[model samples]
Target: MVSRLGFLGVIARLFMWAFLLGLAVVVLYPLLWMVLNGFKTNAELFGNPFALPTGIDFGNYRDAWNRGVSGYLATSVLVTVTSTVATVFISAWAAYGLTRVDIPFNKVLTAVILGGLMLTPTVALVPLVRMFQSIGLYNSFWALLILYTAFRVPFTTFLIRAYMIDLPREVDEAAQIDGAGRWTAFWRIILPMCKPIITSTVLLHVLFAWNEYLFAMVFTNGSDVQTLPVGLTSLMSKHGTDFPVVFAGMVIAAVPVVFLFLFGQRYIVKGLADGVGK
Candidate 1:
């Protein structure tokens, strides 16, 4: 009887594994299809969507690389990189100050910052556009950069501060006794210690900025300044029925985000577990 129960348990577990594996394939099949179709001619693609390409046609990649999408990708990289760095730095400093400093109404200020997370950016687009226009940053890269950094800061700060609040207070005290100022301790000790959470936050913000379409479209007008998501829309409108080129652009657009998510997943999990009580 004991041997029979054990064998049945193993079978059940295997069934569970197979179910989950099937589910994963189900979820990922569309992405796989998109990528594979990019390498096939239109007829070959539509005729047999699931079949492998007869011959690997690299034209899609070449066309995408030599055209508008490549430059758009460069713009995306620039914006996402700069905005992620700015958001992380400013958020780290703000979180460190909020956690370490003994200032009046600090709690209130932290609450205020946290409240920004509650407000959706879409709701504030008109006023924000006007504000940026007045400040001479509208329709430019700086506009997108500033908007990305500002909108991302609240959650990033909240994440960092959650982790910061849990750190050992003794480190800060010891540094102070050694004549280290708040900035010195934060820069030298606390910042270094929060590398995992910082990395997670930066990666998250980069993905967000890279994928965001509503703000990018509203704020950026020039082709030279447009990022991948916005540029892809223009490409689609101008290249109707050119599915291969569109798919090619889509693949190029997905590269950074896919790579980041796959590689930074561990840190992302760690940060969420530590910061948001996950």
Candidate 2:
């Protein structure tokens, strides 16, 4: 009976491994297929989507790069980096204020900030457009930066505040006894402790600002200010017959996000779990 149970356990383990392997394949196959087809010609892709390319075609990448991807990628990097920095900085302070500082109507303020999460972005689109246009910010980089930072602050602040609330009050008290003011304590003590969640927020912001299409399309008109998502769609529209080039462009745009997730996936999981759970 013991031998039979052991045999059953082995079979279960084998089945689990197979299930996980199949899941991995299902998740990875589309990305792999895109990368592979990026190296093929239109004829090759159309003739056989599943087969390997006849040769490594570098032309698609070069053309894709030339056709606005270079400019779009640059703009995307600028917008993403600037917005991520602003969002983290502002949200961190807001979180600190909410969690650490003693102020009147604090709970009301927290609720107000979190209430932003319930607001539909589309509901504000027309008002935002008018506001930006009136302020001379429409079709500008600042417009994207402001919108991204504003929309992201609520969620980012919530995450950081959650993490901050879990920290021991003794640390702040000890810092105060050691002649550390609020800013000093926060910068030297609290902020460092919140690094994991902060990193996760940065990653999330980067991913959103990089791939976001609606705001990018609506806010920016000229080629110089358009991000990768908007620019890539334009590329697709212009070169509809050339699937390989579009695929190559997609691969380029996706490379950074993929690498980021691969490297900091642990922080992402931990931050969300701990921040939300607490």
Best by TM-score: 2
Put down candidate 2 lDDT per residue, 1-278, tens digits, no spaces: 99999999999999999999999999999999999999999899999999999998789999999998999999999999999999999999999999999999999999999998998788999999999999999999999999999999999999999999999999999999999999999899999999889988999998899989989999899999999999988776643668899999999999999999899889888888877777
Model 1 lDDT per residue over 1-278, tens place: 99999999999999999999999999788888888888988788778878987888889888877779988988999999999999999999999989988888998999999999998998999999899999899889999889899999999999999989989999999998999998899999999999889988987888799899999999989889999999987656544466777788899899778888998899888877877673
Return the clash pairs for model 1, or none: none
Listed per model in order, the count of residue pairs whose N, CA or C atoms clash below 3 Å is: 0, 0
For model 1, the superposed segments whose C-alpha errors exceed 4 Å read 1-8
Please give the distance, in angstroms, between residue 161's alpha carbon in candidate 2 and its true position after superposition. 0.7
lDDT of 1: 0.89
